[model samples]
Target: MKELFPLKQVMGFAFSIFFTLLALAVYFFNMSFTIGMTVLLVTAFLQAGLQLVVFMHAGETEDKGAIYTNIYYALVIALVTVFGTLLCMIWGYV
Candidate 1:
């Protein structure tokens, strides 16, 4: 039956493998450092998001809005904190 397929888990596993290969390719294929790093970062984040959504089921519940809001807030706080530190440390703006 369809219920026996475990479709979501399977897809998540497949995507995770694909992303792993993508990151490895970026690292081993002699691409420019900047380009390779950019590709790896994008793919890594996308893969993490996919894992969260599919495996953790972050979007499946009634509190999905709250979950997303929390995630957004965390990201904003992280960005601000990192930029503030960098601004002070690197730019001598302390």
Candidate 2:
């Protein structure tokens, strides 16, 4: 019965809630834009990683390397697209 408790999942959920509350605090505390954004981004990435590892079981598969590689590739593409758009539209780099 002890092994059936799903401790990892419960801990992950609790951490997720904590991160959510931390993000919310940035708004309630009226933090500066930079600080708020920093906190939010940190929590968002941490939550995403936690969900991937804990809930999605990303590291439990034999092909975990491939899965993580794909994720990294996707992140790189997303960053490039976002930064490219910002450079052209907002930074006037066109």
Candidate 3:
């Protein structure tokens, strides 16, 4: 019954837990702001990608190309919006 055990999902879940704990370590260890933020961002992106591919099955469809394209577009838009706001409000570069 190995084929019916959902191994991939289990592994993904375990990896998600590991990443979560790693992020938490940054907080508990009292890392510098830059280091903590870097670690958190890296773990967050990795977990998000893992969830998308493993849990959400982003690559298991016939239209996977379209799905990934949409994801890329959304990422670009989000980055632009965030950086634009930072540039105007925080960086004083309006």
Which candidate ranks first by lDDT, i.e. highest?
Answer: 2
Worst 10 residues of 3 by lDDT: 1-10
- Poorest stretch of ten by lDDT in candidate 1: 22-31
Tens digits of per-residue lDDT for model 2, 44-88: 999999999999999999999999999999999999999999999
Tell me each candidate's TM-score.
0.87, 0.96, 0.97
lDDT of 1 by residue, 7-93 (tens): 999989999999999999976888998999898889988998998899999999999999999988987998899999999999899
Ranking by lDDT: 2, 3, 1
Q: Compared with the true structure, what per-residue lDDT tens digits does model 3 show for residues 3-94?
A: 99999999999999999999999979999999999999999999999999999999999999999999999999999999999999999996
List the candidate 3 regions with Cα displacement exceeding 4 Å: none
Candidate 2 to truth, TM: 0.96
- Per-residue lDDT of 34 in model 1: 94
Q: What's the TM for model 1?
A: 0.87
